[model samples]
Target: MNKSKWLYFWGLLITVAIIVISCHHLPPSKSSVTIKLSGWGGSPVEQKLLKQVLQDFEVKHPNIKVKYEVISDQYMDVIKTRLIGEAAPDVFYLDALEAPFLMSQNVLEPLDNYITPEFDLADFEENLLNSFKYQKHIYGLPKDYSTLALFYNKKAFSKAGLDSPPNTWNELRSYSQQLTGKLNKYGFGESPELARQAYKIKAYGGKIVDKKGNATFASESGLKGLNLVIDQYQKERTSVLKSDVGASSGSDMFGQGKVSMVIEGNWAIPYLQETFPQIDFATAEVPTINNKKGTMVYTVAYVMNKQTKHKQAAWKLISYLTGKEGMEKWTGKGFALPTRKSVAEKLGYDQDNFRSALVAGVDYATPWQVGKYPAAIANNFDNQFISALLGEQPLNQAMLRAENNANQQIKMME
Candidate 1:
């Protein structure tokens, strides 16, 4: 109606238009993507540490969300069932022992294309990295690993007047004899499982599995190494199994003052320290077997699902977890050793008093993987080995029976 009122209305309309135009040029907000990850349950502390690391990842990746699940029982069985049903997590843990079978099944996503130069793939230990490779393609990246080491009770050693750990198998037997009936029930505790004895078999140049995935660890050379175990259990009677002493494991046998020495991994450090705080213990590289160093190494990796809809998000989680920064945090508490060489160096596990011996053995250790048919081989070997230990049958006869049974089972699968 009036000139001044008309001018005010026009100015307000121009101001509103300018504000709308500026808003359109601003950066669009990132769309969020959530991925599921699954792993077996661990100790409370380990779980807390992993949760913290995952939280850190979420903070750095504001657009991504992680849904984590812990399969506490029958982990591999449940994982396999979930995989076939197409309900498996986008990323999950794969142990080296089961990698061969799973990698052959064409269920896993190859990680080579997503890996970049900045990821420093070369920093991983060759043995660990190789475990997840099949037919020239990398299927998984190892998160952590452990190797067997001699765990000795320091007070028991002092009572037996021994100054240091045994350097050879013969010395170990002798030390076992001296330590027995003095400060403990037995001088050495043995874990009769094949996972613990596979290194012994290898020390005599024995092969556990043929290229065809058949069991072949019953040869003369394999028998020779196994005889070392038999002699100590029957003739020397200086070593005993956990079952014989009514203990749960080699660590428990040693912790309960029933044995002076046991072979275990880095996991035993925290367990022993917390569960049996009064017992003082020390670790050393396993005694040389047949004049050569030998031990068993176990490792697990993070693998991707081929059917995943969110490949980039899954890769980000895997890369961050197996990457240097994430690995340092995971292995910082020393529950497990880092699989990456750089992370191991940064954590100084090689220099740690309790873990140094374990780190030294990795160079010569036999990975705890039999073949694609690991269950058949391991189950038969463990059963027969125990029968022989209990004097139910001769060692040679027991091993031959185990070898035949394992091969038969493998043939059935093939």
Candidate 2:
């Protein structure tokens, strides 16, 4: 048995001991890279859903960590300030309305380099994707989108003896007349904001802004479309604003049975279901105007800060969050609609009873982007539009004044 065998056993034990001690002393695998993500605060349910998504992402990417923060009020202003100071989150939400300005500023990282063929850029709706593109470079990927649809209280419609939602603008007006009560309820709830009425301008071949981004919504064609809104509120008196009806929003007006129909986005779906469960409601595409179907699409994308040190990790987060798998989870509950055609088809939102109308309008819905000076244009239009709606001024006069004022503000900004 002897000295040779004993020496061999001793050497093997020593070798095993050395290997175990070396492994124990070696540094723990590098700590996960923490990437900051920021977005405006949403409803409790929405926040919970997002937390679930982030948790799932962490599980899949063990080497990456997420630090989420909520910018509760004046979200864009806060984001812009942080970005100017080079203190913005690694990834954050950027709305379509603000995309043009941000993309032009060069503060956002171009995502084209990180996009792979497998990412299936073709799968996203071209219209939504185009909103985040500037000079052929993609700056962000839309996380979700919502298109306006006619949400009608079925009970109210039936009581008014209407069989279905209006299919055309004329029918909508007639239906509104029949549904409007002396003072208690309005047939239609109107938002009267530029974002809501931009399509109406285009319906008559009016451009909201010229190629140079100056306001041109006061054109003859634009007045023709806007006049319809003013007439509905003043002439017909069948429509009411949320303020007029003591409601916080058009959705609230409709939900409270103050209005039989309202043009609202998908976000209202969950709200109505939760807050107004007793209301029997359904959705249809916004009624066609001047023989053309139109609606507005609102979307927000996940954008990376150009100054982020962890570019690759940030891209991974963006890809997964906007990708089919993550999107399915995020939009599955119908709080928001998917931007990808593949994901939409998988979720069957296009065929869903409540969401079908919204999905139907995606192809034709005008995106709610008004060039780089949207804030100025929107402010001027809203102020003057309400005047027209209230009969304080003629539609033509109001729009002309708005267009002039908005352009002047734009020049001042420049």
Candidate 3:
């Protein structure tokens, strides 16, 4: 009796031990899967917050484990080299500006294939979602986005006795003049830099490039958009270039109260809130021009490297981050605006009380889309454009030269 009972208990224990030892071989439905998630590493606060979020994600998906990797400060350089070596992270950050290049290089897996019918992909902002698309196939889904908004100082407005924020270009000019003072605390900022020219370009229906990706916007309407900015500093003299002001950056001037208003993005919120809490400021849509209302949009997407061996796990991480729940949690800290219309609505960003005007701009806003000529147009025009803003060259002539040189560089690259 004792031998048989002891043998039965031993057999049961050995069977359970074997199952535990073979746990790693279990199917994905029952197995724990580890995936690499990488993005721009940040300050201590951000690191802590992100780690907690990752922990929460692990809690929700007990079978899925996230390995958070801080893709260095030189994010693109490191990411591109990893892609070249076929050792890129399963999930990584891809800027909207870089989406066209990465997608065309066969470096990103098309996300449309992984997306399921039940995912509610339509909840995303069309422009942001479209930015990650190539050949009519979406490569990535946007996690968040930011638009250029005019941030105005209330104290400056009160000092000038202005009734409200400018809605029309004419009012902007007049308001700029009235707010400029002898102390060089100018009314406005010269912020239509090459990095943020999309607003002006779209305001006048000027195409930066045609369907075939050519620099077509260096035309009459484009010139008007370009000149409209230069004229503010060159002719009206009501606004000051960032270089002319001691700030060296437009947002800095607004923060320091050196300028009454400046065009900036949502990332500035935390900085402004923490550093310059005393500044009574609010955000509005960029002043309307040419009888058309418009704003500039930029987005960040979660992309998978085409070379990733763990394609299934990679897709799962990407889909999770861009998914409604994940985006709502990731952007819940108010560090960014959600790219999904549903998430934005959930965040109350669609009709937010404080920054409603800026949120109202998502409908008509145009993405900051330029051709993938290695950012030739942007790089070539950046310094020269800033120089033009400094009154170092005639606006028309400087832009013409920029257009010629950029096209030449593009031709050589082709």
Candidate 4:
């Protein structure tokens, strides 16, 4: 044979050999794919349960595997990077605050196509569901939620001779005054930096922001809430920051007996149980503002990247995680409230007195959304509000400054 023909024949033989060897070694060219599920870092406790749940899912859906990726910090930075590079996970945890931005970008896969009647989107709380929806299509699904609760030391209450938790804003004020110590041990306190916290208002139907994202602090109701917080420093020096309480959090103050009472979230439950095991405490719904119950509701949801290669598989995981049985397992540990109503009952979450208050709060509490420009609004509000809390700025002036900053940001967005 001619030299050229001989070389071509050898090349053809080598190509066929490579194709056969590659096929033989490849792992069964899996129709079953492993999807990546990204979320913020969690404690060991959370990891144990989550790993178990993921394993359970793998067992049931033998064709799919979930790769858990915990993003520890600068969550958006990493997520944005992956998304821009089209290397984002199949599914990721999206905060309600950031969901609007992601949804607006058309980067999230709308679960609508994957949602079946069996998925039961109706089973989830409407308000929380509203937070995940963008332009009338649901973009994410919440596996769990958290709500603010009034936590008070029973020993402190006994000292103050209070028999029951305060039910209204006036009662809260009265209780705070009565509980104030002659020294550093204060009567009551809360995280002042979180202004839109539904539980942090006067009992007068006060709101943090209007539908248009305008600051409501200048309103009479807003002033009342600010005044109540302002009085904590001026009226008495008893109220302490959660940091001062020898605890890492506001709820820690109540747990360590630094303050008689404080409003915080369910996250404090495990912290107190693990850190300060001896504290006697009771939990109740936050005091009613404006004769109506109130509490801050915080929620996060599983969002799919628009750039994902496995849209269908990504959605199966989302549906499974937020579905009734999935939600039950996700929130079954009392670590958080289930976003779905049925799972709340199935997991006996409604039976726990303290935890159950969060169930009621789901109906009345405000969404933790501070609008599209959360960072700007939160930073300005927190800075000015802290100044107000420390008595550096008068309540009205501080609020005005915060309002101006936030409005200026919004106008700039416009």
For each candidate, give its TM-score against the true structure.
Answer: 0.96, 0.95, 0.90, 0.88
Model 1 TM-score (2 dp): 0.96
lDDT tens per residue, model 4, 241-356: 76555666686666667777787788888788888888877889888766667777889999888888888888878877887777778787888788988778877777786787
Q: Model 4 residue 197 lDDT?
A: 45
For residues 1-414, write the lDDT of model 3, one tens digit per residue: 699999999999999999998996777567678888889976677678767777877787787899999866789889889899888888888888777878888888887778898788888878788888889888888888788788888878887887689998778888889999833378888765566776676666666767656666566776777777777877788888676677757778888888898888887777788878988888888888898887888888888877777788778777777788777888788777888787888888867644566567777778876877737778767766776777788766776777778788888877
Give me the candidate number with maximum TM-score. 1
Better of 1 and 3 by TM-score: 1
Q: Which portions of model 2 show Cα errors greater than 4 Å? A: 1-13, 20-31, 182-184
- lDDT at 351 for candidate 4? 75
Residue 97 of model 2 has an lDDT of 98
Ranking 1 against 2 by TM-score, winner: 1
Tell me how far the alpha carbon of residue 302 in candidate 4 is from the true structure, in angstroms, after superposition.
Answer: 0.6
RMSD of 3: 3.4
Provide C-alpha RMSD values for all models, in order.
1.6, 2.4, 3.4, 7.0
Clashes of each: 0, 0, 0, 5
Task: Report lDDT (Cα) of residue 156, candidate 3.
Answer: 82
Clashing pairs in 1: none
Q: Look at candidate 4 and give me any clashing residue pairs.
A: 186-238, 203-289, 203-290, 204-289, 204-290
- Candidate 1 Cα outliers beyond 4 Å, as residue runs: 1-10, 21-28
lDDT, candidate 1, 246-279, per-residue tens: 9999889988999999999988999999999999
